[model samples]
Target chain A: MSESRIERGIGLLLSLIQYVTASGSVTVQEAAAHFGVPEQRIREAVERVFMAGVPDGAGDFIRFDIDFDAFEQQDVISVTMRPAFEDETVRLSPREASALIAGLTLVAGYTEAAPERVAALRDKLRSAASQGADTVAVDTLAVPLAAQRIRDAIRDRSVLAIDYRKPGAGTQRRRIAPVALNLNEGQVFVEAADLDKQGMRTFRLDRIEAIEPTHDAWPYALPERERTVTGSAQVVATRAAAAMLRDYATSEPVSVDGERVRLDIEVWSEPAVLRAVAACGGDAEIVAPASLRRAMHRFAVDALGGPSGEREQTPRD
Target chain B: MNRVEAEERQFSLLLALVDTSVGFTKHELFVRVAGYQGQPVGDALERMFERDKDALREHGIVIDVVQPPGDDSNQEARYRVLDGVLGSPAELQFDAEERDLLDLALRVWHEGGLTEESQRAALKLRADPEFRGGLPLERTPGRTSDPDGAEPATASILQPRQRPRESAFQALKRAADRRREVVFDYLKPGERTPRSRTVQPWAAVLFRGRWMLVGHDLGAEDTRTFLMQRIVSPVKDRAAKQPFEAPGDAATTALAKLEEIWATASVGVHALPGSDADIRLRHRRDTSEEDGLLVVHHADRHLIADELTGFGSDVAVAWPAEQRELVRQRLERIRDAHAEATGEAAS
Candidate 1:
């Protein structure tokens, strides 16, 4: 077996022993599923465990009691005789601690609680791991108050009256039953049933100018069919820009043809797509969907005073 | 040796190490450890012992080697797995709610390279009775009603992509954590070749879906943020050098400096009053409507340009000649590609 597999198997063994001891007994199938391993692998790991012991000692070996009936018929794991040293505290490896620390720092960014509370929790985790106290540098993408209000409405099954700023269309007041808040690629989106439009739509949280929770409760159950907006765009970019796109793109690229990378993405709104293209500078261009391509040309022409140098009447005109 | 035998040997070695308090010499370990026993004491045994030590250490097992207290000669050292370093504290406890929160925190790495470590940690915690009574594996909770549900919404937001195992990110993180100096070849934006840089890493920060390492350059005598992806070569640690102290608020300071740089670069554009571009730009912080054009201030002009291009004809860039040119070129590229495709169809 590869070294990594063995290492992972060891970690699994340690965790399994601890789990079986604490939970009294667990089925082999459940253990396999929980550890994301095949049942046969778990069985092999367990069989190996039965052979482990101190050298040249008659009674100094680790022991386990397995029910033969459950093993043969039901595939249940009953550890009647637990390891003597099961109560030993397991310390996290340095790598494990670092991974957790990085993860917690990321979580602190999305948390709605006070910064101090999150910091304290992080400190506690560091102390538990016996690591030095250097504060992690995290870009706390603070959720807007409007987004928070929408989240609360989703939880309470209430309707939200929001002054939403839709791209190309300006601010409009609408009442909608907020269903779910999705976080895709560091952006927050609210999937709601638009009362006026009478269909499902997604609104970028940052574009929500103002939101007020109404007393009216949601009258309908969540729609069974998820409203997913998926599209693909092809673009040619510089190597540097391509790397950035690979990192920030919603999903993996569909194909890479020299400098051009075609991306299959789930877009929340049309403006979001424009925002992505804008971020790429001149390095990336959308190659498909004639409407989107024309939109790009128009956006450029409009920004440059309509291919004529004459000042446009308005930013959108 | 067979895979099972290798595992059995490792497990036996672990048991032997954990069972002892006084420590063991190489000779004693060869006899006491199940796998090493009955083997001839020679070059083969020594090599096997050395490899086993490294394998165990890689799994986060702490083994300590120290000379006997009264020993004068440089003889064989006694080795022991450090006590209390491999296990959780007995007094450390987590309530169900705290466990749920931890579950949420751990779930953030579901898509990243840290998923395995996070999963193991979660399983370790779940072994405790206090945290075991919660729901079985479920997806992140969509609403607050099921806070302890499968997946937390926050975790889904800002999904971190899995980084390469040998990425510069891991190296920089290690250096920052150890307060060590690192040297690497870095490629700045628009630069073709990479230049070597010696820096004292302070922190690794993620902003706008990209990882940046904040560090103090020794040669330049200035603090800078190096994009992780732009790092072209392996990050090498300077050995046998005194580590420098990281500034207390290094991360915050670096982020603020980046934000400051962005604030100074503004682009002027024209959009309809209620158009999507106008609404979104107006909603953005540090943006204002000036005269007949809206001036948008951003940290990264390229990123802003990409976003603006999506608006398509709905907005116009009025100022910042370079940004306007970038948009024009991008539009031209798209138009040319479409024309070529259409021409082929007509032919």
Candidate 2:
């Protein structure tokens, strides 16, 4: 049997018992949502598991003595006679402790939270861990220097003129009304209203060349739309490249051989896919959408030089 | 046993053990415990008891074993839960502000391997009476401009919103915890082919938003740190001749080495003022300007090379002939791969 399931089950039961004991009385629905479990599982746990107890030496068992009457009719659970134990608060398993500690370590590097307080909290967590808290290490990227100024712009709701880098295109100057900063997939992005394009644009935080503060306030009141419009293309990827593309594959393998397989992948940006293909270093090829294939060639040619560069050669196929 | 029965058995066993003044022997437990009762006395029953002990220990319940004096063969032994072993102290408390910080940190792990771990930890914390009545963290006012009330810009800017994990992360972590050897295909930077590596995983460290596994590489017979993203194939556990013992401080050692590399490694680049590379590299942490060139500090050469390659003609590597060669090779491979067009017009 998978031990994780058993661990999860036991942890759930103990936590549920503690929650009900502490809350005095809680609805089954609320408990279900709180634990992210199904209502049926909660009912089963309460009705069949916690209602009973272990056997004592004197031919009698110590029962939890739950108020099953209220539970049956009102969807509420209450533990009347608690189990006979001192200090029954749940202790975190090693995995659990490591997760929290690692997360705290990362947050400490960039957050405005006081360093002393965070350190104290880490100590507290270390003490609470059953064992082996020190085995999991975490390090986070320091907040970029541009991040603080960007936060200030978002807070002030001010229009800022900035130079932003577009992949395959040189730096372009634009005025944007700053909104929120989003961190996704280890990269930071700023959601803003682009005045030049009259649309919302998400700019990579690292790609901003310079921020020129403007006194003008944000003028548009546009609601945020779907952040990305995914586009799909078919490609033949080597086993190595296929592994990287697995996350973006939209359909089952169109066909598979020993070495290469055809996959239909969906991506938010065509240029990003081109870059990924370029990173693969010829392990992947665009098999469909003639325009995209041509675009792939053009993307690489431009990266090397222009159409008139000395390296430009004839087609391979 | 099924899940429900197993859970009930463990809980009852824990309760029985904690309630006892003197621990119960294996035979006594099998005869008395509700779930263990009525089982025939045999090797299977003994294995079940041992497995139960392991499961309880995995859940952080420390079961103390009392043995007869000098009984090396374990002919007579009893098991019971030590006092105060099941939960943290009642006084292990957190203030409102501290809880708020913890809440934000815990919330950052979503849809990742650590998500469940964080949730389980949060549940344990919430079970404390001191934490009662703190159901939802209050949002700071005036920062709720998002229509859906997304996280405020301040919090988002200060922390990572995603873990950026690889497919082999969970497998590697489990293999490390179990002290098992794992085999996977790894593609190192600047290398076209992937190589199979067999290693005894020691610990996994999250450095710079990437999961890196620190382990003893069998082929190299030395401790090596591998970035998880470079693992190109599924991680498979290979039974070792004997379970390897991990160094207790493996994580700290790996982190110290990474920091050392980050401090010592330097690369020089030339970027035009107000250019993309200029802005990106200038604001990078630990970056400095020397001789009218940007000195970018990096932990790994190939990773930084990948970033510089993205800049195209806007930036050029100035020093460190090896790094310059790496970037040059990558650019050339990209160019060579597409140099031959398939009879198509430039789109």
Candidate 3:
């Protein structure tokens, strides 16, 4: 085996030895499961490796005293004597501590997890870690109430009256039976059954203006989600815009010209495609499907025209 | 001479080190340790010893070296494991609750970047004498509900995961830990070209859902932050220069700077009531309503513009002439991209 690979195994082996020594006796099967290793590796590790200690006078050797009979017959490993390395504490390297601590900090930030307990746990990890673990940090945002409420509604199977705003439309009250929730790139999306629309729609949690539980329960058995691809469109993209389009593309993008790519994309909704095109900001254009291009033109024109109807525009702040 | 397995050799060396009181000289170790006993004592043997010592150091074990006075040329030295260099592991103990929290933390990064570190840490923690008895902590009530009825690895039902490990993140983090400077090509948003930056990385922070490297830009001669996503080239270590010490409070300082920017960069928008813009912006953290206008503060102006552009005709930029112009330009581009005869309409 390579030197580094063996070194990594040494860490595992050392930890395993310490565990065995501390526990006094454990089944090989139990040891294998605990370490997430197969039973054969565990048996080999004990029998072939870590069985020897320092050589003594006259070419003799001092070795760890294991119960050979019990180990061979009953698949049990009992370390009777450890000639050296007596300590049994689990030591975390600096990087190990950092990874764990960074993860804990992220969780503690987003949820109302017990603050005192997290703090106490963090301090313990810091104390246990080697030097240089504290250099990594993660920023936390406030707990989003909308996400919390939606999660509760999903669990209760309760019907909800939510005022949801589509991309270009005003908030419309809809009775929804929310099911699964997904988070991508810090945005929360909920898949729900829209009673009025009679189909499932994915609603951005942030776009939900207000959500209240209805007295009625979810009316039917849970339904499988609708197919994601309702339509397809072709677009020409500049290099920069291609990078952004790659994220939303349902299929592989093919290079068309120098610094440009042709992408055949699945369109989940008209509004979604328009927003993506707008985000690209002219670097990408809808090449075919004349209707989408027309919609894109109208989308921008209406946006530039500003708010219509009752509320008169306030002067620019 | 038979080649001994690396593990047995290392283990024997460790046992010898831990057993000796005064320590062993280089020649004595080669002549005595099981792995090197039959090998010829020479440069190759010495190099092998050095490599083993370095490997042990990676495991956080430091061997104490005792040198003879006035023997610099002779290279007379002795080595042994010290009492506490390997840490007083026997004294380390975690209660049941802490163990559960540790397990939860370890499971956060499933299989990338930090997974190896977290897994090794888990193995080490399982060695703790108290680890055997504790059942994994139960999920806290009310807030703990997984929508799919899948068992969550963490205590919280809301598993907001870290973004997939950034390509440049591990390099920058390793540099920060070792205090090494790194060089990479950074592509700033809206720029057509990338510029090479040599920076002394100090901290890696996850700020506002993005991985950012906070470091001192050697070229700019100032502390700067670079978004990891914008790094267009592989990060390579500048090995000629010696490593330098980083400030103890690098993370705290970087976070404070980001927070300050987020507090000051405010934009105003007029959204039709009950529209996507109105609802999302109003619910956004740190938003204020003034004269029926939604005022939002963010660290990046382009990000705000991009979000507003996504709302299409439902929202309009209301203030800060520069930001308003930026939104207007984006909208015009979108409109012109689909205007059919694009040349004259684009200009």
Number of backbone collisions per candidate, in order? 40, 0, 1
What is candidate 1's lDDT per residue for A133-212, written digit by digit as tens?
24344455545566667666665567888888766465899888876666544566788888777777777877777787
Candidate maximizing lDDT: 3
Q: What C-alpha lDDT do the candidate models reach, one value each? A: 0.62, 0.69, 0.70
lDDT of 2 at B225: 92
Could you give the interface RMSD of candidate 3 in angstroms?
Answer: 5.5
Candidate 1 local accuracy as lDDT? Answer: 0.62
When candidate 2 is compared with the true two-chain complex, its DockQ is: 0.32
Ranking by lDDT: 3, 2, 1
Docking class of 2: acceptable
How does residue B17 of candidate 2 score in lDDT?
83
lDDT of 2: 0.69
How many pairs in model 3 have backbone atoms within 3 A of each other, for residues 3 or more apart or on separate chains, i.e. clashes? Answer: 1
Positional deviation of residue A31's Cα in model 1 after best superposition, in angstroms? 5.0
Q: By the TM-score metric, which is better: model 1 or model 3? A: 3
Better of 1 and 3 by lDDT: 3
Instruction: For each candidate, give its TM-score against the true structure.
Output: 0.72, 0.83, 0.79
Model 3 global lDDT (CA atoms, 0 to 1) = 0.70
**Best-performing candidate as measured by DockQ:** 3
